[model samples]
Target: MFTGIVEELGEVTRVEPGDGVTRLVVRGPVVTGDAKHGDSIAVNGVCLTVVELSGDEFTVDVVPETLRRTSFDGVEPGRRVNLERAMAANGRFSGHIVQGHVDGTGTFLSRDHDGLTHFAYPPELSRYVVEKGSIAVDGISLTVAEVTRDEFAIALIPTTLAATTLGRNEPGDAVNLEVDVLAKYVEKLAAVHLPSAAVDNGGGEEDR
Candidate 1:
């Protein structure tokens, strides 16, 4: 599990294609300081297991499914990605629980100088987003500022604008998005206990 708190900004050094898995070499000094084989590192909100280690650089294999589901399909050498080590057992949970599993990808629509950023997402994932709920964008935890039928916005603090990949992306760029897992659980539980609420299929009621 992760806390969606970015530890370092890492760069993809190389991408090697193989039969079953694609290898990605990334450079992260802080997150890889004591990293070893089989250790887990989150690259751009995707949980990747360290396959090999070389000083500050480590290799992780991406399956085809991951590429299809995440923005990693467009990842290339020299791309900067958000990096975070798995939360330690005693680590403080400053942010919400992040599985490093990107539910889907969203496109950056626009942002205001006042720090409100809007993103256009796939319509299918719209049910998962909620105003004021926690969401992870590129692995950084943020609260939903508002929601539209197919898009959502977040209020970014200066620290968020300066610390992670969100600072670098422009309009039309794809970003990895993971909605709160708790919300999904709630939906599933509600389906069993509150059939009327589940009949809405997690979109909730707009008019009521």
Candidate 2:
């Protein structure tokens, strides 16, 4: 698990394509300071296992499935990405729980003068987002300031503007988004008691 607290902004050093997987090397001295092989790192909200480590760089192999599901489909060198090391067992849980699993990609729409930034999310995820709910955008934990059927807004503080990848994101840029897992769990658990929901999942006498 990750805390969605971005430790540093990492830069993609290389992207090598192979038959089935692409090798991605990122330079993050802070996150890779004590990193070892097989450690998990969050790259723009996507959990990736470190396969190799160098001086200030770590490498991970990205499978096709991950590529298709994230904004990394055609990611290239020199792109700045949010980086966070997995939370330590004894570390303080400063932010909400972040699985580093990107649920879907959202589009950066606009940032107003007041730092109210808006993004268009997938319609299916609409139900999980609520005002004041927690959401991870490109691995940085943020609270929802407003929500609509297909979009949500976050109030970005000055620190967020200067520290993470969101600062450099342009309009229409794709960002990885992960909604609060607890909300999803609540929905799933509540579905069991909702007659229509049970039927939608093909539940019947056998399930009861």
Candidate 3:
């Protein structure tokens, strides 16, 4: 798991395409300080494993499915990525739980000068978003400032504006998104209980 706290803004150093997987080498000095092979890292909310390590750089393989689900497929060598090492057991839980799993992608809509930023996502994902709930946008943990049937807004502070890839995102740019896991759990539980609930409410045949 990740904390959705971007430790540094890393640059993509290389992208080598294979038959079905792309190998990405990213330069993240801070995240690579103690990194080793087989460690997990979050690149723009996508959990990737470090398959190789070099000075100030680490490499991860992105499969076809991952590429299809994330914004990384559009990235090039000059692109910047939000990099975060997996959360340590002893680390402080400063942010909400972040699985580093990109549930879907959202398009950047606009950013107000007053710090409210908006993004448009697939309506199917709207059920997971709620006002004041947590969401990871391009790997940064943010609270939903507002929500609608089709989109949601979040307040980004100055630090966020300067620290991550979201700062450089333009309207229509794609960013990875991960909603709170608790919401998904709740949805699943609700679906499972609905039938029983209906039966309890006189919808079931009476027991002989």
| Top candidate (TM-score) | 2
- Best-fitting candidate, measured by lDDT? 2
By summed lDDT, the worst window of 10 consecutive residues in model 3 runs over: 199-208
lDDT of 2 at 203: 33
- Residue-wise C-alpha lDDT for candidate 3, range 100-168, written one tens digit per residue: 878788999999888899999988788789999999998889999999988999999999889998889
How would you encode candidate 1's per-residue C-alpha lDDT over 3-25 as one tens digit per residue? 99999999999999889888999
Give the TM-score comparing model 2 with the true structure, all chains together. Answer: 0.94
- Writing each residue's lDDT as its tens digit, candidate 2 over 1-208 gives 9999999999999999999999999999999999999999999999999999999999999999899988999999999999999999999998899998888899999999989999999998898899999999999999999999999999999899999998898999999999998987776678768887443333321100
* Order of quality (lDDT): 2, 1, 3
* Inter-residue clash pairs, candidate 1: none
TM-score between model 1 and native: 0.92
lDDT of 3 at 64: 83
* Per-model TM against the reference: 0.92, 0.94, 0.92
